[model samples]
Target: MTRARRALIDLSSTSYYHLIARCVRRAFLCGDDKYTGKNFDHRRRWLVERIKLLSSVFAIEIAAYAIMSNHYHLVVKVNRQQALKWSNNEVICRWYKLYRGTPIIDRYLRGEELIEEEQLLVTELIEKWRARLFDISWYMKNLNEFIAKRANKEDGCTGKYWEGRYKSQALLDDAALLSCMAYVDLNPIRANMANKLEDSDFTSIQERIKQLQSNNVYVKSEITHQVKQPKSLKPFGIRDHARTLPFSLLDYLKLVEWTGHHIHTEKNRHILKGTPNILKLLKIGGATWLEVIKNYSNHYGHFVGSKTVLRAHAAKNDVSWYKGVG
Candidate 1:
């Protein structure tokens, strides 16, 4: 059975979610089409810019992302509290950037005076919009819809751009979060699109690498870039803030490098050996962690985590099963 979005997204349990959106008919709409020799690679830049712009407006923070030929992956953290803190006027102003908003909101923004009743009505509307500003559904909707419209206009044709509703997987624990982040960051390498981390364009890994190099914090074979984290995406941290990722930039780089080497070797060798210390610190075994980073969606369902955490989440949602888990 297809579960409802409400059932899948439970912010109280976890705010991090892995989202995937693919092009219609699985076409290479955002990359170079070998068959047609059409260079659509520029479209990826459009997506990255739009996503970042939307992130700036919404309370959602992007933790990791990878823009591929026909699809894109994102790990995002929702900050409901941040949205709740905004004033009614501030909410209206922010929403107006994406949409014209209701007539009442328009008038309010135009500096037109409102009566006591009218002010009350506008406040009601602002309240709803405020909630939407923090909503993942609304955020994804605005993102896809805007991109679709722009693409259609550019293509001089109208039809479906995205295949369907974006697929989402909730990260039930830190293990799931870390695994999914690496999976997304290493997608280009896995697909053979790029052979190196810095070569992986339109990915968060490359973005972070560029930032580190620019600041001179990352020198040859040294992890001096511990203090600096990507500003656009969520910072990788231990406990500086509750919203940050559960590891530092240096730790993540090491883990990714180790994972990339193993993945490349595994292509030729069926078995993998050795363990990354970071995984040990997180209490995740090498083989299990490799399985997760290689095939996250196949190994887990709507909720990704250990059996214990999965069971707890299923019980909380009153679900008899989640992708065949009790």
Candidate 2:
């Protein structure tokens, strides 16, 4: 049965989530079409650019992503606290970037006084928009809808472009987060589209590698302040006063590289390579970690975590049971 998104997503349980959306009928809509012999690789660029653009406007941060031919994966962290801290004007300014506001809002921005009722309405609208700024549903909706419209126009047809509502799974612990990120980053290699991490185009791992190699710093025209890390993707490092992934960036890169090697080897042959140190820190057996990343979708439903954490979340949500408990 299809459950309501609210029932599935509990922010108090966790802020990080793994999301997936597929092309309609599992067609090669974003890659080279084998049936028609036409290339649609440009569509992948469209999705990547839109994802980054929305991340800047919304309070969501992109932790990892991979754009495949028929589907895409995203591991994002919803920064609700950041959204709450935005002033009313700042909220409106951010909202205006994606949508046009009412005349009252324009006048308000122009320094013209609004009537008491108009001011109240403005307050109500701002509150609603503020909530949406950090909402995953709204973020994905904006992303999928924009691409659907543009792709439809180019294809000269008017119908559904996406399969359905994007699927989401809450990451209840560091184990789940780490495993899911590796799974997403290694998608191309698993699918046999790329043999190595560097060849994994349109994947966050590739982008991070390129940025590090070239010593590039992303700057946005609208952002007045400077950020030391890549602006589009979240920074990976030990958690401290500033928000970041719970692992070091170099360690993560090594982990991904190590995992990619194992993935390429024949299944029956056991390679004598040692596991990356990050796996030891996370307390995950390297063989177990490889299985989880290889079959991530089969292991979990709406929530992914240890058996204890999954049971607790299920009880809190008033459900009899949850998947991925084993």
Candidate 3:
């Protein structure tokens, strides 16, 4: 059964979520349509730029992303602590970037005097915006609406451009988080759209690769030793730290490289190489991890985590059964 977004998203359970927004009817609305020979590649850039801008405006961080032909994947982390720390004025400023504030906010920003009642009203509005500034639903709404408007206008028609609603999957542990991030980063490779990470356009992995290349350390030995991930992404911390992705950039890159090769290889008879140590630390079997990434959507529905975490989340939600996750 389909659950409400509110029920599925619990910051207490976990802050990270993987989201997907697909074009209505699965049309080639954002890429080339071979049947029609219509290229809408520019639409991909619109989403990429907007996502980057919105991440800065909202208290959300983009951990991984892949903008595909008709859909996009995002691994986002909502920072409630950061949003709570913002002052009223700061909240208004951030909200105003994406939307025009109400007259009361205008007056507040202009230093005009407000009666006590109006002051209270303005305070309430600020509080609401502050909460919304960190809300995943609000963030997706802002993102989808912008692109929908642009695509509708360009197509000379006005109707639904996206599917009814974006899908969300909760990542409740390091194993789930790591595999989902890799799945997102390797989307192009899986689709045969790009053979190499650097060739994958409009993806976070490609962005990370480009950043390293610009600094002249694109070689494997150097990247494995020293290349820091771009600041635009949530850095995979070098140590096993609290409240962060648990692997270093080097390990992540190597894992992606190995996984990408397996995905591209056609022969099933080839002997599989040994699993990376990171998977062992996470207590995920190597073959199971690969299978999860290979058919990510099939293995998860609403929540993706360890068996214990899944059981606990279901119990907390009063759900008698939780399916599709191991």
Candidate 4:
């Protein structure tokens, strides 16, 4: 059964989430259609650029992402607090970037006084827009809808492009966040689509690697350069920074590379060698981490975290249980 979005997403529990969306019938709409022999590889760029644009407008931050042939994965951090801090005018400005406003909003923007009713309407619209600015569903809706419309127009047809509602998994803790991010970044290697992490096109890991190489710094606590990291993606911070991932970028890169190497070497065999230091700090066993990364989608339902956290989340939502409790 499909649960309500409100029930699935509890910001009080966690702000990070893993989202997946697939093409209808898994038809490779974003890649080369084997049947039609029409390459749609350029569509991947469309998705990436749209994601960057949306992240800039919304308070949500892109932690990790991978654009595959038939589907894509996104690990996002919804900064509700950031959205709350935006002034009404600021909210209106951001909303107008992606959507046209009503005449009343236009008048308000132009410094014209609105009537009592118009003022009330403007207030209501701003509130709604403010909520949506940090909303993951709205973010995905805007992204998927834009791509669907463009792709449909190109194909000269009118029908559904996405399989259905994008799947979401709430990350209840740092461990879950790290693991899910690694799973997303290693998607290409797992699918045998790419042989190396740097060669994995259309992936956050690749972008991060390129940025690090270009900057020529791996051990620095912070990259003070304006181009410290990919502007489209979230920056990494070891401390509890409000707008950054709670980990070091170097550690994350090492973890992804180590995991990818093992995953690419043998899909079924578990090698407990050359585990990264980040894993030790997180206290996740080498074999167990590999299993989770290899079969992440199968290991959880709407929520992913420690068993204790899962139970607490279920109880908080007034449910008896959630899947992946085992």
Candidate 5:
């Protein structure tokens, strides 16, 4: 059956996603070419920094990622609960960091002097940015467009650098989330780009490793169960100083490292046979465990296709087109 690029995702249903974006030309969009020999390592850094910066603006928390020669992967959790809590003005204030809006927007977001009319305008503008912040399409568009413009200027070329559209998979549960994260972190090992996850350059795994060692990480040690959850189904807190379960922060980091080693190589493949232990760590039922493992096939861009039924989606994902249709 034919399918559109993306089926509509019930945003409220899932707060986490696995997103992938690839270059237009499959050849050397990211690596050093043997023929022309142009390098794009800087471009990879551009993406990483941009990802990190965007996280600061939006309520996105990046769990894992890998940037390859022609493509990149991201395992991000959208804090919809937190994002929805922000006042309309707070949303605009944050978005204006990545994008430049209008003159009134600058004054409003910056806390500068404003006319009574400007105050009213700011109120209305914030409403718009607030709405767009939760929409993944808007999030991706903002990220892609910024990078594309900068990249085009640097390469002295114009037109599309990205493929048709970015792809995303909603993680049905924790198994899907952790496994996909491992898949992303192990991308370098699978491609022979790096012998181990620790050495993978320009990857979140590497950045995270550095952060872990240097103690630059912002991950809170308090588990959600211990700390008080916000009163709202949507959290009233913008950034919670709490962590997920299995409180030993030290143990969790070790587990993440061990997971990286598990799928990294042929000779070391046997080291990951502690099925019961692994399952226990991720906290999943055996049936759910097997189902998630089955989804990790080679057919669909290194991970299973998303649950989104593409049939009900639009023909294209262009923002203007979507607005017109709506």
Candidate 6:
């Protein structure tokens, strides 16, 4: 049966999502033609920086991301409670920062003289803008538009640079969410872009690793996470270490590392080719990792490793995701 189209995403129901956006040209933006070029290296840095900057402005959180040549993927969890509580004026104020102000907006902020009725109209307009500010469409619109313009300028061209709309998938369960994330992080490996997740440039995993290593922060699997994670860990992969949020930054990082390593193992290679290995590993049903272990080894390895190494690799995944987005 055909599936019903999703009504507008209800931020209230769930903030987490797996989003994918691709460029218009078949293979123009990425791969050997892209990420490696001297001119475009900054583009990789651009994506990570933009994600860090934008996530601050919006109530969205990025969990996992992989910036490939032709396309990009992001897993985000929206902070619905925070967004819903924003005052109209606060929302409008934030929205203004993303785009240039119009005459009406400037006049309002400047406290210039205006009729009582005119003030009311402006109030309504701002309310609308505020609502848009919290919406994903607005976030993606600004993100995409800004990059497109920058890319166009760099290429010395002026025209539609991206496709019409981005594609989105609902991560219905932890299995789906986790699998998608692993898929994103494994992008470079699958494409032969990098030998391992750590070497994958411009990814969120890499960023997380660097931060953890530089400082005394927990950035590994559950076996390693002794404390909670920040809110940014919720699906928004990027965040300043200073900020705090729900969940153990430590434990969450641990989980991703555990799942990720399993995904990259030789036996799981078939999954990259669309086999059911991922399903089994997550144990949706008959789907279980134990079976793979039996087939690939004598018994299930079941997350046996060093926390530091595991975390380092996972952080590398995060960093690469952010870096590659450009």
- Cα lDDT tens digits, model 3, 149-197, are 8888887788898888999999998888898999999999998899998
Worst 10 residues of 4 by lDDT: 218-227
Off by over 4 Å in 5: 1-7, 103-122, 215-278, 281-326
User: Where does candidate 2 clash, by residue pair?
Assistant: none
RMSD of each: 2.2, 4.5, 1.8, 2.3, 8.1, 11.4
**lDDT, candidates in the order shown:** 0.84, 0.87, 0.85, 0.88, 0.61, 0.57
TM-score of each model, paired residue for residue: 0.93, 0.94, 0.94, 0.94, 0.71, 0.68
Candidate 3 lDDT: 0.85
Q: TM-score for model 3?
A: 0.94
Q: How many backbone clashes does candidate 6 have?
A: 44
Q: For model 5, state the Cα shift of residue 211 in Å.
A: 2.3
lDDT winner between candidates 1 and 6: 1
Off by over 4 Å in 3: 222-228, 239-244, 266-268
lDDT of candidate model 6 versus the reference: 0.57
Cα deviation at 326, candidate 2, in Å, is: 2.5
lDDT of 4 by residue, 238-309 (tens): 756766788878777878888887777774675558777788898888888988998888889999998889
Of candidates 6 and 4, the better by lDDT: 4
Candidate with better TM-score, 4 vs 5: 4
Candidate with the larger TM-score of 1 and 3: 3
Whole-model lDDT, candidate 2? Answer: 0.87
